[model samples]
Target chain A: MEKVVKILLADDDLEDRYIMQDAFSAINLAHVPFLVEDGEKVLEYLAQMHSDEGILPSLVVLDLNMPRLSGTQTLRELKNIEHYKDIPVIIFSSSLNVIEMHECRQLGALSYMVKPFTYEEYLLSAQHFYDFCLSKHSFPEFNSLINNFK
Target chain B: MQEITHISLDTDMDLVLVHKRTMKLGELAGLSLALQTTFATAVSEVARNVIEYGHDASLMLGIMADLKEPDKFLVATIKDHNNNLTDRINGGLVYARKLVDKFSMISTEAGVEIILHFKIPGSQKIISSRIEQWIISFNLEPPVSPYDEIKRKNKQLQELAEKLKESETQYKELTNSLPMIIFSMREDGELLYANSWLEEFTGETLLQLNVNKWANVMTPEDLAARWEQWYHHVAENKPLTQEIRLKNVLTNEYTWHQLSAFPLSDENGKTLYWTGFIVDIHARKVMEQTLKDNRELQEIKVQMEEKVRELKRSNLELEQFAYAASHDLQEPLRKIVFYSDYLYKNYSALIDERGQLYFNNMMGASQRMIQLIHDLLNFSRIYRDNLYLEKTDLNVIAAEAVNDLEIGINAKQAVIEIAHLPVMFIYPIQIRQLFQNLLSNAIKFSDEERIPHIKIYALNGGKEIQLIFEDNGVGFQEKHLDKMFSLFQRLHSREKYEGTGIGLAMCKKIADLHNGTITATSEPGTGARFIVTLPKEVVV
Candidate 1:
């Protein structure tokens, strides 16, 4: 049976979403990539999945800057929820300050990646995004990291 | 009398010669007429007396040459039938002597003989050729009874009084009726006369304004000055200009008045009076005082506003400083923490002990971050909290601080020398905390070669008590003295001098709350001396 790997992307840009969609199609991924426009939508998507399907996302991609709720806010809110709190939220942004990077980690974002200006960087990010979904998700180790943070 | 046609009498006559041409006594020729005029006026009084009492009296007349000088005299003879005529004739002779230069007379009860001489102004010879007779003498009756004497005295007195009244009326009209206070003061400040101006300004009548009564109306302040200025002005005969505050007689309200007076004097330049005119200026005086008070209040308000602006600017600077530290310095701290944790976690077996030590150093630097945050928070809290003041004894504070730090003091064998302290108004807990921090610094940063000898001495500087803390420690260079009181400002390595570098800075904040100053002095190897100057007169 084919693994229906679940993927989530929290970003506020329409053009970035369109470009990443094309890059993921090139990799021929079987899983569905869920794209939310803001941090609040990202939390809502995760909570809806826990309540309706009884399943958590394999991975989540977060953008640092958004209008009302940013990627850091999404990470903090997800860490507070009990059922979906252990899921890994990766940080992606156009401009990254080191303090913000550390702040994201402290707020429970698992990893960080710089979003480059060129289309080549977007394709590379898309390749890495497909690999992140395909790799078998580890629940025990990520759950323990969340436990240490608390 | 030869050919003398106006002859009326014979003087030393040879009566053997008579007038060849007789003339009436009332009609006479030129020179003779002139001579008769003189003769007539000369004896008119005698003639009136004679005609009224002893009528038809006569005198003998002649001319005689002086034997000694060039003057000549006319002689006249008068004889009257009255028995009292002889004495009267003698009186007439005295009258004739005054009229001419020389006179003589002899009289019997029947008639009198008088000699009157006429002399021209420059000629010595007598004018015997033109002699004439004009007057005669009579008896004078004695005065009447005592009642008649009184009546005559009364008539004279009435005439004298009429003259005095005329003069007084003229003076009164000349002095214009401005309800004058025409006063004459003696040189000794005695009021000689004061007029009705006092009665007009005050309700006092002229009779009530006697010297003693007017003196009673003077206010106590005026009496204290003794009217000395007015007295000197009048005494020296100078112009008087003075403003005096006096209470009105009827209203009892203080009225400021200005008196301008000129010295009145007689033609001989004597000081006769100080004639003054007064004008009320109470309203102007009040306005001037109000202007002065407003100016003082405005000055105080401007100073207060300036101090507030200064305080606002200082507060802005403190906020800016904290924000700048959080935003700019915080990024570097994140890099340190991130890299150190990365080196230890990802490459733990690959990195040797030296690299481990580097990571440890990075961690230590990151840990000083909390110190910076704490010091800034403490400074901000000082600005935010309400200051409570207390009467504090510095001696007790120092003793308690020494006892509390017995562990550190005994370990380093620290010798703490204290001095006499003053009782002053302060924040008691703040002062004790200040002592604890400073003593800890002295004990922590000690000399490697010797026991920490902390000498604390205080001296009263009249305005403030200056306390000096001297310690035999590994002192810093003088170049870093200014940075010693900055938050997290470290001059030495943590391996050498172990501290968060906030103790001295916190002590500085406490001193600032007391409106005091702290300064440090040190050499490379010699000990350090920290001087704290606190004002004794604290503003609570």
Candidate 2:
């Protein structure tokens, strides 16, 4: 059987969460992306998976503006964990600020994407995220793959 | 004895006249030139003695006949009433006695008298009648030779010389008493004379100053430049007036002084010497420098004020931009999210009836948002873009604006009356936008009861130009005039007049960019007039 590609997504806005779900569903991935309401829920889900000895998600998508443990803070805590350090993280934000994007990248985010205003653009961004999980390479090579999205 | 001529011994010139008379008498007597000189010399000595020691003195010269022998004597006798001559006559009498054939002196309580005799040679015989002729001839003598005239002139010149010396001493005293330094120098830069003031001020003697050429007393910083200027003036043979620093010996501090020198030239225009004076000018120079520095400081203060004003203006613009972004931009986004979520959750039910209305409302809000963003970008561009002013005709711009709004004008059947406008230096593109916005506003707000008549005209104020846009439109109340030009302030409801409400604000911004003002006056349901005043000449 093909290995299921598990993805975790975190966002604060309900509408943005719904749009991301639809975008992911349209791409026909091997498994559904696990959704969380905020950066704190992402951490709780990771802890539960670790305690239960479940498989770690291959990729984590985090929204920059979220309550309790923002995307950059979560990335820092995730990188500090020995087992979760290898999990690739991507930062999704509505702010088109290059400085915030650079800060997120410095905190171990593998890629940064501006949240698309339309469904079609979100669908395209979702395809790039799925491509990130499939392509196995060094962090630098993976970062360059989605660099044009910035 | 016979008297030929005599002069009173009152003055030294009288003594010279006495000598001349005696010489003439001796020449008339039959004495040789040697004898004449000898007898005149004896007579002058006794006469000088009588003049020195006597109150009234006179001399007599004549021939004396002796009955005992054939010898005839020429005699001279000096007499005075005052007998004070006895003590002073010894030396002059002894010398006279040796030069003459015979000499004698007698002093008495009444007066004193001196006598001298020279025997006339027998070959040059003299008679009583000849003595009368000799007296007449002596009276008629014009002058002995040029020597007499020269002797008289020499006496007058000596007296004049004495007067000149006295006046020169007075001049020296005057210069020494003056407060300033007065000096004279040779054309070659050697110091000739300096008044006592120079010595007192510098604590150096005139001799020392001459040797040093004022090098030690002058400030070193001013020395080289002063020398250069001095040489230039010397070369040009011109007067020099310059301010320089001089060290005061007592104070040991340098102070500003004005050194002025003029060349003392001869009739031939050759520079003989330079006479100069130095006066203190430190206080004046310091006051002038202070005034200049104060003026510069005032200029800097004005520039700083202008900078602060510009900063405040830009800060206000930034605040407005932030407000529009956070409020207007986010409003539509929130609505779109709300509507989309409702549709996604109730997709089957929303597709029946109310779903279309929700979609339409969402689309309208988004379109309005896009328009607001576009307008905000344009508004910000007015601040960001560099304004280029070019000389343009106002008539051409007005015509172009009308042409751009042709569709609107035809749809409303609006009539635009443009007066002949003057050419002006202005930002053509921005001014074009201003005209288009104003014309469009006038057309959009026209009264439906009346045909819209728009008049565009300009007036020439002396230092500024006034552009007027008058319209017969359904105008606003005067109370709302204050909010007319502010960003996003709508005077009418959105259903009545469709606008993002940035037109008048943009117009105000454009006016401010040109350093001009825009104001409007209106009465409810009547008409409106918008006036724009711009400087006749733009600075930048």
Candidate 3:
């Protein structure tokens, strides 16, 4: 029996979310993805999923910049909880600032990734994300994946 | 009651009795020792003259007591039987007149009588008639032996000599114990005295320190000016004070000393002697110099800080320019790219062939415009952010830049030879950008007939490291060399070369941030070489 992996995507831009969904569907990965507009909604969804009645996600992908609570703030808050500390979080931003990326990693993010400029580059990033989840590895193992791609 | 004693003036021995009786009367009247001797000498001269000239002569010593006033007097009377006095006796009368408080002679038919009176010095109060009566009775027995009188006068002389010696010792001790040098120079060009402190300071005795040549010890640089003022003040008879450097005999080093002097003059205002004190002032002079140096250094530091603040303000204005180009311009530009692409995709059938071609050109121009804005942002943001410095390997930075441009390198088929590079303290991202821009420029301007060849290497330049990038490409003319690294300066026409002309400018800006320089050299159709010199370490 094959287990269906649930993924959570939090972004502020509607067009960016649409493109990401199209990219995932184009790759033909067998997965369930939940979408949210901002980090506040992301926190709300996570809090509900912690109870017995809701479903918990296997991976959370967050945009670094948002309207209310930022992605780095949410990632730090998520890592503080005992139940969600082991769940992986990946930060995505338009900036290639190494200082911000280093801060994200220090705050217990699973990986830090840059946004693609073109649709073809976006497909490649999506394919890498799909392959990363299938491996079922921890945060340090995720760093190895980025180095191999590099 | 009054008592009187008489002594006959028959011989020299009688004259001696008259002198002794006179001194005893003065002592009983409480006169000073000097006044007592004056009274005795006057009585002896008058009595002797009377004996030599007059046939009968006698001396009477008595006390005159006042019943009402507290004052008492000692009186001497000499009488002779001969009436006429000789010229020799008149000479004695003139000498006796100046010594006594009162001198009178009464001429009678029988003889000449002389009387001398001297007021006694005592408490001005009447102690009743009984005290005056006792004084008269006491003088009546005062004609003692001549040997006893000679012994009493000799003892008084001995006491006076002892008092003069004691006063001289006290003056010497007072000057010796003073902390500073107290000196006096006499009018006849002689050094009179210097206290013991002067000997300790100069390590020379008073006789050895020749006062006439004292100016030789002063520093030559200050001597001429200070000596001129010294002589001017001395001639005017005014008090003088001066600070001068003097030579220390032990170390032979010049030390600052303060000398102050004033003239001692008589009632006629004649300059008698120069008296002064000398004090050590070297420590205070050194401290004053230290304070002046510290104030100068503090001023220089403040000026440098002001220059840094001015530089920061200009850099902030450049950042504002970058922000305007990014957001205010890119907002409209992004829409053009998005809509043009959309119109070409979904509405290509409805548009004419000429309109579709124009739309394609519009998209191309907007895309290039976006790249220009992005490069400008990167250039201006260098000073906008704080620089983080660490030990970085230049080889690693080069490898990363090569990896980033691997696809472009293969498409152009460029061959890059990298030599060993040294590690430096620098910001890693900016250094990588510098390498990437230089390498891509080499690939972009490749020669049509020949393959592209590039060499990247570093050489030590003592205090700096030189990173050289050489390329075998279509080189530029030597005349265009000065414009190579300027922003938006294009040497070639847009039809021949496709560029925004900001790559080399970005490389130059990055080098400048590290306190370094980038220079280019080229010849037509030969090659181009760029040399970037960077410091090994940066202080700030």
Residue B233 in model 1: lDDT: 69
> Which residue runs of candidate 2 sit more than 4 Å off their true CA positions?
A22-31, A123-128, A136-150, B1-540
Cα miss at A114, model 2 (Å)? 1.9
Better of 2 and 3 by lDDT: 2
DockQ, all models: 0.01, 0.02, 0.07
Task: Please give, for residues A39-69, the per-residue lDDT of candidate 1 as tens digits.
Answer: 8898788778777875677788888878799
Candidate 3 residue lDDT tens string, B425-539: 9977788889999998888888988889999999898999999999999988878877888989888787888788888888888898899999988887988998999999865
Put down candidate 3 lDDT per residue, A42-77, tens digits, no spaces.
Answer: 878888888756768878899987888899888888
- The fnat of each candidate, in order, is 0.00, 0.00, 0.00
Winner on lDDT between 1 and 3 is: 3
Report lDDT per candidate: 0.64, 0.79, 0.77
Candidate 3, residue A115: the lDDT equals: 68
Candidate 2, residues B410-502, lDDT tens digits: the string is 999999999999999998867888999999999999999999999999989999999999999998888888799999999889889888999
Error of 2 at B121 (Å): 34
TM-score top scorer = 3
Give me the runs in candidate 3 sitting further than 4 Å from their true place.
A1-5, A18-31, A118-150, B1-304, B313-350, B380-396, B407-415, B477-482
